[model samples]
Target chain A: MNHLLNIVRKELKELMTIGSFVSVLIMMFVFMGAGSMMGDQGESITSPSDIGFINGDGGLWADRTEEFLISIYVDTYGISEEEARGFVKVMDIPLDDGAAIVEGMRSLGLDAAIAVGPGYSSNLDNGIRAVISEYYIFTNPGLLGSAGSSITSLMIGEISDRISQALVSEIADPDLTPFLLSPIKGTDAHTYIDGELHSGVRPLDISMGVMNQTLMVPVVIMMVIMMIGSIVISSMGNEKENKTLETLLTMPVGRTVIVTGKILSAAIMGLVYGIMYMVGMMFYSKGMTDIGGLGGSSPADLGLALGPVDWLIVGTMVFLAIFCALGLCMILGAFAKNYKAAQTMTVPISVLAIIPMLLNMFASWGSLPTAIQIPLFIIPFTHPMMVMQNLMFGNTAVVLAGMAYLALFAMLTIFITVKVYKSDILLTGIGQTKLAKAFAGKRIR
Target chain B: MDALTVEDVHKVYGDREAVKGIDFSVRTGEIFGLIGPNGAGKTSTLRMMSTLLRITSGRITVCGHDVATESDEVRKIISYLPEDAGAYKDLTGRAYLKFMAGFFADGAEAEKMVAYGMEMADLGDRIDSKVDTYSKGMMRRLLIARAIMPAPKVAIMDEVTSGLDVINAFEIRKIIRKISEQGVTVIISSHNMFEVDMLCDRVAMINDGRTVLCGTPGELKERFNASNLEEVFVKAVKG
Candidate 1:
């Protein structure tokens, strides 16, 4: 019993390292930051009131439709009718002028615009279905970007019910009134994404389509980065543990070659893993799209598919991201005393990868505040995760900028890794400082 | 010609000075031994010569190449076998030898080195097995073969026969003597005074990061009126 206790105590001592504690703390902070970002996004999505109203009908029912929408907005938000009017902008424009509608929405900061047709009231009174066209402005492809349009659709449904209730009370024909209760039907929605209008496609449909394809990209990228990072760091740790690094370092090879060789090999392995994961994810995404009925209108039909050149660009970004991860792992691995400590070294990379992945999943890059976006853009792994969305939206400049930044980041990290390889820290294991020495002693103990 | 030179070498790690102004030189084909007790800075001195650690102050040169500024050139002509060295466990013994040999030579020349290493290790069929399966004696033999197979002008070995049985130690000493006979200068550090007295042509006895005595084994014993190098070390360090 005493021997068993002693063995358990020794195992605990070996497992508890400063590196492990620090890694756990970093992971905690990353999760906390993600939660805060998610909370902000929730607030942004739920309280949307940026709606534009265009009454082309100029009839009693059209006016009534506008009035009912404002009334419902006021009730839902618990605001006065005047304040609700201030939130909903009214425009007098021709229904055929799609360009004017887009310009009006952008200039008015409207999330969506509802345009009533010229014969809406007359058609409804004559027992014919009335048409209301919805124009959605998509500033980003994020899941939250379509929140305003979705809420406006619900408001339109409420207005149709309210108009039906008013008609039923006025008319004595109960059978006709029952059929006319939901007389107002929406026409095919038009979405303006990044200044180009896509006719007949709702923002929600496009958002769902984009989500179906790309939701797994960030996850796969995160996994691949962590996988390759662990491999590189563990390689260093194993070399140190086996005492083979001293022999390799003293060999007639240049430090740069050693650094590059390790990074390149790990990157190749990461690419292989990434390809395997992406193939599996592709089939899974296809199956999901088919089951969810999103396959009827592929993203290609909506002009959201990547061309050959775009895929090449994405390939470059992924390669650069892998290089950056490998370089970073090499630097962290230099401080590792052995394989156990190297496992902890992968935490920072995981945190970096996860931050971008979560942000890409929940929020669009354009929807995020500058403070959040800047850091997200700076993380090397963020580029590959975001490149597909940017290219689909024809934001070529942003994609190019990301690739440039990743290249520069990869170069800088490789330089630093080489410096570490040449330094005594590789062999001495970061014992240059008194605090580090204390930690090293604790780790050994 | 001198195969290696250490001029007033000092190594500082944080606040501690592991090797303080220790100086020595080894001639061509000489079996030079750094004889010291544990923590006497023998391994530190060997590491500095191997270019694995930087000299905090002073200089070391191998075959007219400075270890600090011309480390690549110095590395080309010297081989370092750390006291607790190991090969990649996942690789077979022959593969490990081939990988190390590729750094010095290529293709046919590399194959030649592998054959010679296999001959030196004398493990026969076991050389095809993974390095992780080898016993301690076999591992040591394989490492010794790797270090000597490169035909380095100067070989720096730290505690070459440490943790080995008498038979393994005897076999390694004979191998070291044979390498020295082939005109490769050898600098070996050891805590075993008996081993140093028998294997080394000349010895530097270091204590507490400084050399206490430096002479041929016979001269050191005669000067101290001792029967063996262990007594010589005791008398020198105590006095």
Candidate 2:
């Protein structure tokens, strides 16, 4: 036990002192903290909001739409009449001058740019509707951006209907009114997900949710597992190759002591990495979208009101995953002849880690067919990858079940790792079988 | 009193026999040598005596402690230096010695042992430099110092000068003689006949894992009617 403690101390010192470890650690906290702080902004469309108007059609309808945008901004932020004119800037963007519009908005630091499509005038007359392209400087983001774009489109449509109504009313013939266009409406309505009927929930909301769940969890899982695997393998393999392990074994210490010490060291390092990863990702989440929390809006506007329970879910799942990864690293390290061969093992292990993450991104257990969902749940890595999604969807039962399985899996993996150290192949640097020549080989050390 | 005992120690690897029924004993304070060619299993025999390799069907003891059942106790009294053993690369030479010394003693005793190890290294101020910065000879000297510093009842050194320049090898040989003179029993294995001739009080010629002949270097040379220990080794292995 004394030997084990010494080994752990030695391992941690090397890991922490390495230049790359310290630098990367600092980068993660800095970037992530900035992102999180920025993301938690309020969502109310307030005054001093930068709005861009790119007029493509150069027609009466385009001019009218631009006027409506300025009025809405004035009303939304409750600006006074004197300052309302300064709240919006309308630039004449020619049909072929789309590139200039992008550059023009970038310079103005605009939040949302209104790009009037070329077909606006013709489509309004012929089809009673036209498409207006919306570009947010941060690009089209979550709830706030979608809400802005939809509001502009609706205002334009209302103006066009009024114009159509007035044109027919001015006609001398009574039959002219009968020939006027009436807006087409669908009779049937359907929704994919049930429960709380929230308003203004756009398809882009689903897209934002998918992006949030996929990017960090899958990629980081692969990175952390492979990194810990490499460190453990290199440490053990180098000891064997250099013949330091032989010297250590002959010391008056039990083999289990040494092996346990190594596992503890790597596990702690993996946990530290896992924590930094989550923090950085939370901050990165802000930079991706001028969403509810970051954009000075209520986080609930984006359905992203994550509480302490959610954090606990992420923490527990990540901890279990690291524990399991550390065990696998120890076992593979012992099995290897030296560092190089052990490095080769990392490739397959990485692929295994990534498979579940990929699967979770496309197939949430709630949506997947029952046949496929059952098997995916059985795969241990699926739990870590799916924990966030499950919590988001309020599938508390699945998260609890996954936690139970992962705990058992981690225990079993560590048990096997400990058993491997019972007999070691020390000096020869050749692992004949079962970590050493346990049977059909040398009974000697 | 004997410092080490090996009774019919056999080591089997898979379908092959690595060490077969080797018996030997070393008196306290004696510098003993196992001299033979490659694949002679001298290393295997020494390994079993050091409690490094488990015996197949025989008994071994170090300082009256059974190497098999009481391997930890056996380890307390002896230090085994494997061929081409290496220290932690990033640690300073002095730090490496202290790390090893920490396993056996503590407080002033450990500090005293560390001081002795550094003194024996003869590395001057370079002992404070990382082992990675040390040359091959310097590393060997540092490792040798770690092994004998604790002043164990018996020190098992395998090829203490296997790959060294002449001056470095001579210096290490001188250290071994000094260790013997201090009444520390030393078990050394080497193919270098001259080293055995110069340093060993008694020598054993092993071949195919068994000791074929054993005596003092001069006695073996005279008995085989040979000019030196090398000729005696050659004759015994061939027989």
Please name the candidate that would achieve the greatest DockQ relative to the true structure.
Answer: 1
lDDT minimum window of 10 residues, candidate 1 chain A: A292-301
* Model 1 regions more than 4 Å off: A1-16, A172-174, A177-181, A194-196, A293-297, A438-445
Point out where model 2 deviates above 4 Å.
A1-195, A202-204, A210-214, A291-306, A367-380, A426-445
Clashing pairs in 1: none
Model 1 lDDT per residue over A133-168, tens place: 889877664776565567777887888888878877
Q: How high is the TM-score of chain A in each model?
A: 0.92, 0.53
On a 0 to 100 scale, what is the lDDT of residue B105 in model 1? Answer: 95
Tens-digit per-residue lDDT, B9-127, candidate 1: 88888888888878878899999999999999998888888888888988899998999999989999999999978999999999999999999999999999999999989898999
Error of 2 at A116 (Å): 29
TM for candidate 2 is 0.68
DockQ for the candidate 2 complex? 0.30
